[model samples]
Target: MANRFLAGYHAAFNQYGIWLSVPGVDVTASGPAANFLLRPDFKCEQIIISGRVAVAAGFNVDVMLPITVPTKRPYVQFGVAQSGVGQYPHDLSMIGTTAQIECIGGCLFRSDRLTFSNSNASGFTFYYDYLVFQRGIN
Candidate 1:
């Protein structure tokens, strides 16, 4: 049984070694900004920013980032989800309530701040998660 297990382990190691020895296959999990693939045109610094904001009804708020945005208009991929009892981008008149939440702009990114606009007459807490990619600079 020990010999059989040794043989299986050896076979698995050989397969993994062959896969790792491939030219463009990278599986190094070195750092936060490490590229797991060998794509030359896909090397860019990225930062994940996430937060929650409570906006008053019919008001807008600007949330500051911990790090400065690399450019005036960097590539910001973001998502915002409503947490409170409100329907976003749709009128809640069918439910007999006028509380409709509107994201004024999908996601606005400035140099070092993110503007969140809530156009609802009822307050809501928004949870946002985004990835900021550094472009045009190595």
Candidate 2:
């Protein structure tokens, strides 16, 4: 309940970008869209972000955070992309359907619209910002 109060206050007072995301698309998130597996859900997920810059293709993570074990900064992990890899929608995707995947940049998503630039592996079909959240007590 305290967390809720804090979040509500922060959201109203802070000047940041808010986006919805798929649960487990990382460790802690909301979830995916309904029937998202079929089509590219035109739902704009809100994300709370600050100033964003662009980075070249690679592991150009904007920020690396320390992921704690529900307390006392247990383990170091990550947070949001400090820089924006993609600015416009067209920059990130070619078409709603499958395009010629050039970069096999690992399993970033589970859909056909999403592809890589030049990779040796296409592990998963990235449909959206898909991820498996840590359920129950980890």
lDDT per residue (tens digit) for residues 19-124 in model 2: 3333323212223444122111242322221222232344322222112122211111112222234333223443343545544333221211112222224432
Clashes of each: 0, 32
Q: Given candidate 1, what's the lDDT at residue 1?
A: 10
Estimate the lDDT of model 2. Answer: 0.25
What's the lDDT for residue 50 in model 2? 22
The candidate that wins on TM-score is 1
The TM-score values for the models, in the order shown, are 0.42, 0.22
What's the distance in Å from true for residue 1, model 2?
A: 20
Instruction: Name the Cα RMSD for model 1.
Output: 13.6
| Residue range 1-138, candidate 1, lDDT tens digits | 111111001132221110121233233222222322322123454333554555555666787766553433446665555644334332233354465656443557886788876665445555444555533344
Cα error of candidate 2 at position 18, Å: 11
- Model 1: which ten-residue window has the lowest total lDDT? 1-10
